[model samples]
Target: MERNAIILAAGKSDKFAPFTYEKPKGLFCVKGDVLIERQIEQLQEAGVMDIYVVVGYMKEKFFYLEQKYGVKLLVNNQFGKKGNLYSLYVARNYLKNTYICCADHYFPANPYLNDNPENLSYRACTYLSGKFREFAIDYSDAKVITGFNVGGRDGMAMVGHAYMNEGFSSVFRQFLENEINDFGVSDLFWEEFYAGHQRSLTFYMKEYQAGEIYEFENIDDLREFDSEFLMNVDSDIITNICNTLGCVPNDITDINAINAGLTNVSFSFQCGGEKYVYRHPGGTSGNLIDRTTELFAQEKAGKLGIDESVINMDLSGWKISHYIHNARNCNLEESDEQLETIMDYLHRIHSVDVASEKNVKVFDNVAEANKLMEMASMIKGNLKREFAVLIEKIDILYDAVRADAKRLGYGLVLCHNDVYEPNFIYDSEGKVYLVDWEYAGMNYAANDVGSIICRYDFADCQIERYFRAYIGHELTDDERRFYYAYIPISAYYFFCWGLYKGSIGENDGFFFLSSYRNMIRFIDVALESYGIVI
Candidate 1:
């Protein structure tokens, strides 16, 4: 005897509202298991191996279940416009003796628990004892279904599961075919067919006690039953976010890719009529970036009004913040007034009060970057020769910086380690906003200056002007020399960044390769000045 299960999950689930706006009702979790996953498990326990899911709304989410459970998916393209019976019609070929259920419904125990594995066909129902308000049934003296009264005085309610034997399957298929061919009745529910053909077909009604089954009619209903249902759902990130903000998934109207960093991807989205920025951290092999500390710094910076408004963040490294409308990435090409404002902005960031307990250090960043380079060297092909040369040059730079460290006057202050041109956003209101704090930490302030010079290619005059603007005086000999050498070191670090990112198969506008070329040029110039071999 072949036993198969079919789950009707093709309806759009518009009644569920906000929750279904971003995900299908079938994917929602009650207690610990996703709604459909629970049904699949019960079917399996009942000795049914082949499970077919009919999906339509947000069908892509079902792919994960298909792979994990080894079930087949049948798509109903007209799901958005059609009803549940259309989903069943699409799976007509599998009408062989089968068990059918709804994706959005959950049963505490299998109704087919003790039945003979291959003997009979029955419709699962429940007597009225709870909030279930769907089709109410009337049974004959022989315990067969006589008719259904939708939303009528409910003594027995249809619970969305039924078993069909080969004989019943053949009759149901002919009823559907005749309805489609002769009466052109394609929009009727599968249960409606049983009602219309009661003279020719009868179903044994197997009723369960109330509280044994549930069909979620809305998000509020589901939330009331299980308070942590949002978190139980595998799509916790999206659902928890929507619930906390008092907004639905449909409120998130647009998601525009803002920028792609070596270790993070950012996007701008509009939610509930307000714009926000979302940061999605990328995968990394080693501890290249500490997101915990990064979030800490971001919180501190937001308090100081140096960063955007942070809405929500978690250890998972995903963040949502307020989006500044009409803000442009600041560069040296901006008017002198704008550049000076950006200079003041950087100084202000350096001046922010550092929490004494935050033990985040600067060299931790270099250690992280070094790990990336090591991982890259192991993975990347044909770059061994070039990488070897870069490493040698970096070693020389490291030695020189260490020998000169005592006299450099490099202040250990909070620094935005990646202060490239795009990291600074200038709004039309003349307020300079610093963004992308992925590498922010307590570091030598000079390192940030060097990063800006190399990143923007600031002319000697512009560099001098920025230094004067920031320090309120001319640069001391020690400061000037340290800044000059630090430029090449920063460039070299970024170049290794390119190699690391490329090895990981990341292709964000060829960022890593560009960093490599800049590193070579700066290394040669800075090394020649120090009387070191190029």
Candidate 2:
């Protein structure tokens, strides 16, 4: 008795668009091997001698399988018009004690389909499942499938592979024949016969632990399960990561997603009882961030006992850092004590030597706004006109601040140019730390203070209190004027930066518009307070 296998690859698989238009879903590859090809290789490894593939859309593409892998092809012309049961019905004559599966599904290990080639039929099920929108399985004490439904809350989900003996295959084929000929149910699914006609058929169950089975229903589904699937399509990144860690890929126990920023992706994984965080900078981050500058700033901050420790970095800006356990973002509204602690860290950071070559000047927004102006000039629409008007208002604010800065002569310090509430982290021991120093550079101390105050929407008294805490003395009339002057300047900085990001398509349109609105609002407040009219 020869071990036989059947692969169902007839459906159009329209859910996976444009790519499916070129070839059938089975030809899609995971890791390196094509989906159906991997299945065929595994079947062959399990001693399957006779292999059959039901091909429909792009049937000619599968013809090479006959020569390459000794696969027999059964073409279903109505594959585009009917469901999978119709495809199975076309191959009813070949139904016997054989292993059956879909071509698009992948199994991590050989399922050993020929293990028990006796006349017993069984379906493979997985205990680890999430958000399964299709079918679910329910099994009884004898390991027999008792019930199946769509919205099943249990863990058992089909792995899209089953072993069927002659008795089960004959009954299934007869039911499919009746549906197609007597009931004219051309769109019926083969699983529906097992699920609906449960009283007549008993499918013995074989359960696999999670992560063993992966079914790529569509491109989106494929991406969600493995976001890094395409990054290391040939598994090169995993190999590189293994080399870097001096461990096998399997030794790294878990990889969990970390929601950090809009442009980049981060994940936390554990290996050898130690956890680490890995961040892959997104493509657009290169447009908005200078990784060299960031690396330098973070190193300097780490030396000053401020930032997280960088364990390792790859050439492609993939960073592996020591994970900070039990840490949460600081809430400024927590108390005055927390505010004082954060202020102390900021002052120390300002006291450190700045390695960044960039500077924040009062007239910096003028140059930034000009960049926006130059970009807006090329557009041939009303958008250009609106941006032109915004530039006019920006010019007035820039001139006002430049004149004040020249008169007051504010001092410069190493500043975290992008200060926000979320950047401050508080650990379990009440130690406050700062993260994300991409925009750190030598800038006016007032710019950091004003940026923080404005971002937190601080009241005038709160602003004065914060300044007093940092300065450790009363602000003279000139110093007060200098501090107030940077409020609108910092707002314009964010506004111009946001516009710059939008011009280069670095972020979404809503973020760009919000930045413009903030710039205008701060300009108005500064003009009204400083008695400068634009």
Candidate 3:
């Protein structure tokens, strides 16, 4: 059989942050040497030099290894969504007589040889005192692998390294190719597959002495093995995580990356036996959001008991908040009861007595978007003419709403300018709280109301329900006209905001068009029914 090796480096290593934020865990430098390079050098010393590395998280960074160390690179495009089982599946063809390796594993010396006593393949493990809840191995007296457990008292803990002969690889590959297509089991570890098929396979347990192998489950492990990473890991996220929770890096575990956030990069971790979220700003957030005002709004909301998930938020725009398990966003269009709950929170937010220079003037934003579109060189041709016409229509509606605000004594209150489904976190106990105060400022309370109406795409008939549910009573004709006019103006501002985001190279054309088309219909309604034309 031909000697070969497959190294799995495609995992994002959420626990390895904030180093993995810049590069994958395999690229981390330990003792002045790249982690993956050391593993490759050790494999070469064992005469298994034909190494194939499957990379996904930071695949480009591993490209230079092809020329430097004569290793072949295989790409796993689903690395972010899938686990190491998929990484190994990507290299399924090269499993014969192969030493399966992990990129983050640190071996003190070469563990392979050119010749062995027999053709038997093995699963390597290290004995532990039974404290950590890691995968444990169970074997018979002849050392044939029999079964596995999640945690065992003083038993061998399963390590990543393993070997497979021609026969072993042929049988395992058949199982892999069959089960991988099932999306339900796509996230399973390769050992899980082995656990399922242990009865049909023959394998031996190769136990290693203590201090011979290193998995570096956390930063403290890597720092202990190689003293370079000392008192602090070089990660601002970790620094902030430690500072906010008053705990060391090791105290933070179960770190899973929450990649679904719209304008932030976040990870959820458990510290001091409680789950919390750490959000680092992303996209155009640094330039678009005023962190100072956001800090103040959050503090104000905290005191008002509207939202208290905020643990700490720094000037650098990184934030830590307690995670609400099984929480869902507030979608009023779906549930009228949810609408009442969210509006109560909105009403409380609008009633706050605070002073801030931050102000939201919708027409002013439309004017600014006009300037940004021309400056980014995006305005051109028929699109420019259409935008000009839209602005003209918005001007009339803007004047109409301004007249209503002045004559009716409608004053500005603290408002959450950005109100969408995802911005509200509702827990299982029927408790809901608003999030993302970056856009909150002194604005008309209807600005918040219009946000709910505009985002949910409420129909003409449904406006009355939202209006009555918000004001807690049947509306007067003047109040009805005042609120109806602001919804289209809100839609126009959203359209302009989308245009501005697109000019900066965000994929927001759908947003711009949806709001623009919606605004055009409502703008005409306001002009005929609500506009004073003064």
Candidate 4:
């Protein structure tokens, strides 16, 4: 007797799209093999002589399979119009003690289908069985019972793929007839016939253990699936990431410097005779992976003339840029033009047209001020009185700033939120690179500009000249007012962020708090220098 198999590949996968837009669910590949092909290969390994495939959506793609593998093809005319049960019904005529299963699931194929005992009519169900879901046999007669959801369990009577015997076919035909009579019944016809029936002999098989199984359900899942492994590395992506900083993987002498950036963690490795940077995200707060994907999409869009090169992003995840060797440090005596380049780069990034949905407000001055006051109220240290007075002054200043902002109808742009000299990297060729984009979003542009200007001490003549050059134009009275106002507001925002970080016990929380305290002191000094009361 020849063994045969029928593959169910007709379901309309509505949930898996975009990723599945061009391919059928049956053709969805893991590693390299398509699901249906894997199923076919398994059946062949099981020594099944003939294989029948029920193809539906994008069935044309699988037409070559019959010629390539010499398998039989059964088409379901109502493929997309009907469900799996209908597809099964259309292939009923081809059933000859055949092994029927879904194409989507991964299972092994071995042990010729004809090798199973002819006396047994049912195979055991593995998933939903027993207390521990373990296979146990009755000692007296070596019969299986009590554990089977239907009735029999271990040797009570075993069934495998051999059930396609003439008697079983008659039972199956009767099952289909019963389903046809119950026209209003919404349940799958096969479930009613096979699930609770006692006559169906059942046997247990070991669990299929190979690769992990994951059911893709949504766009997020698709994104996750794509990111789970590297994409086509043979593309220009690896080269682009290497050229970003004028250095290759070999140039990373001090691995510590390479790992300093908080956005991503990087490892050096060689692939296909070339070195590469393999970086993973540092998680959600600063989602490096998501940012890399967005940057890659934007770059592709820009190349197609669909968008502007606002961020100057390179390839995705592992970006390669011309690494600047022997980069010059920005000293107090640095030329005005050097400072201008840094400020311009920062301005370009802060003014990019980020989508409104991604434009999240990370910090609000009023709310931050209130949080600081609350923190002050909770303090039991020696600086309690000083903190109390400072909170009161901060509240008054916050209210004044809010009122002024409302009166002026000022709108926000993307601000770095954390702008300091260290975050700005200057190459030896005079190009500037902004490192961290974690706190980047829509906010007052003055907040970033003010933070940069205030944090760096420019008491020297050349430094002050550099500062003036950085802005390109003299600050207007209104702009100056906002800049000065932002100093304290930004300080309070940092202070609150520090307190939150401290509450969560994040790494170096005290360091952030100390930095916030320094910023506060700087704000007070700026106010005194301008002869303004807090």
- Please report the candidate that would top lDDT against the real structure: 3
Off by more than 4 A, model 4: 1-257, 262-264, 268-279, 283-333, 354-386, 406-409, 427-429, 454-467, 496-534
- Candidate 2 stretches with Cα past 4 Å from truth are 1-104, 107-150, 153-248, 314-316, 354-384, 387-389, 400-413, 496-521, 528-531
| Model 3 misplaced regions, further than 4 Å | 113-119, 183-185, 220-262, 266-278, 282-415, 419-435, 438-445, 452-478, 484-534
**Per-candidate local distance difference test:** 0.71, 0.69, 0.77, 0.50
Candidate 3 per-residue C-alpha lDDT over 1-534 given as tens digits, one digit per residue, 9 for 90 to 100: 558899998988877665676678998877766889999998888777799999987799899999999999999988766767888899999889888899988877777755355868888888989476667887899998888887777888887588888899999999899889987566878888778888776778889898788888876577668765533445678788888788987677766777635456787878888999888886467756667767777887787777888889986678999998898887777788788777888888888766534343222434544554554446433445657766787787777777788999998787778776678778888778888887666777877777666655557678778888888888887787788777777777677667666666555534566566667667777777673332
Clashes of each: 1, 0, 0, 28
Instruction: Give the per-residue lDDT digits (tens) of candidate 4, residues 108-184.
Output: 44434445655344343333233332233332233333243333433322222223555665566566656743553
Query: How do the residues 60-160 of candidate 1 rate in per-residue lDDT, one tens digit apiece?
Result: 88988877888999999877555566777889889877888889888767755655454567888877755445777888787788888756554887776
For each candidate in turn, the TM-score is: 0.56, 0.58, 0.62, 0.40
Alpha-carbon RMSD, each predicted model? 12.7, 11.1, 8.0, 17.1
For 155-175, candidate 2 gives per-residue lDDT tens digits of: 787776888888888887777
Off-target runs (Cα >4 Å) in candidate 1 are 1-234, 239-262, 265-273, 285-287, 353-355, 364-366, 382-385, 456-476, 508-511, 528-534
Taking all chains together, the TM-score of candidate 2 against the true structure is: 0.58
Clashes of 3: 0
- Which is better, 1 or 2, measured by TM-score? 2
Per-residue lDDT of 436 in model 1: 71
| lDDT agreement of model 1 with the native | 0.71
Model 1, position 18, has a per-residue lDDT of 41
